[model samples]
Target: MDENYSLAVPFYDLWHEDGHVPLIRELLPPLLKGVERSVIEIGAGTGLVTRVIAQETPAEIYAVEPALGMRSVLVNRLAEDPELLRRVTVLPCGALDVEVDEPVEAIVMISVLQSFPAEQRAELWRVLARQLEPGGRLVFNWRERAVPVPGDLEVMGSYEVGRHTYEVAGQVLEVAGESVTSRFVYRIRQRGVVVSEDEAVVTNHWPAEERLVSELEAAGFSRDAAPEGMEVWRLP
Candidate 1:
């Protein structure tokens, strides 16, 4: 996992609540209807999607998050709800190293695929497959994307936090085959003056639909119909 999230943790929920969380709320519940045993959430950031999964089912949840900053918020979020505190377990480990006591019924990875590069995806699929029961579902958000063109910096989101405003800006720095290197700038302003600023250069992989299908298929997964931007596959 990219430890870069340590820089984005402060502004994550503020940005994603309106970005992709709503789509997960709409498209993921149906897939969990019969999942009553256990479920694993790969990149469970700050308990947003974890809360959604908890509400939809009574299954035991293993929320895997490796970033210390994000995991702290996630643990605190779960503490607020006594039921969630007892039902959810937070794993402080990366995807390739994470493990569960037993195979789970389903696995959810929302906006997490980009963290794995083309070279590691095969190992990722293999790791995930080992943790799931045969026929268990692997669900995540994915959409085919055209290669990006390098672009200048642009402010992606700005939020008011009490007397200060937090701003997140980004720029596409370079594009390699399936990897896109980008820079994210985080700034805090007080009355329009920049107070504190931090930047992180991260690389994300966006494989095409055909490549994704090929990889998943090679790992013994069969695709299932899902909403336009969502993907669901079953381990056979």
Candidate 2:
């Protein structure tokens, strides 16, 4: 699955502007405060989470994102604010491309693990294992399927930004084993007239929860007690 988030950058804001803000604001602070060294955030996206981290923690941050369109939007946010610029470094790279001078105290991936192509997911986990310092934390969330091999349609919701109205609708395109491919169609209109539209098809690698925990163990992580809806791990 090739996801060019650059093409969807314009609608990215409409789709998820502050969508995960409360979750990020709530989940990230305690984790960052626990880490004495730096924190690296995989898939920084539009940088709202990054902004929160910058505001809440004193730790330096590596905000890694491979998509230029999303990166530009996030970088612009850093430029617009002194706080983000002071503590955050926007890295133009993805999971495998990560290389930091110092081993980090934490590695966070929010809504990023599923996007890794199925073939490369093992390596992705391996990289995550290697990035953290001993006793360091790895925090992430998984895409939950209501049932095995789900094929369903979702309204996804819509919103208005300024005078423009955006409607986001999506449906399941295919389900292969544990993985599901979905299609999203975005229609932007002004004054009830369609102005622009685009569509994106994404396939996520979703395995069963047991298998996922097994994979993380195989990648050299032992699970630590974590809150519901999140996974926390520590390196031996």
Which candidate ranks first by lDDT, i.e. highest? 1
- Please, what is the TM-score per model? 0.97, 0.91
Index of the highest-TM-score prediction: 1
Candidate 1 local lDDT, 1-236, one digit each (tens): 34688889999998898689988899999978899989999989888999999999999999999889899999999989999999999999988997999999999999989999899999999999999999999999999887899999999999999999999999999999989999999999999999999899999999898999999999999999898899999987
lDDT of 2 at 123: 90
Model 1 lDDT, residue 169, Cα: 96
lDDT of 2: 0.78
Q: Give the lDDT of residue 82 in candidate 2.
A: 87
Model 1 misplaced regions, further than 4 Å: 1-3
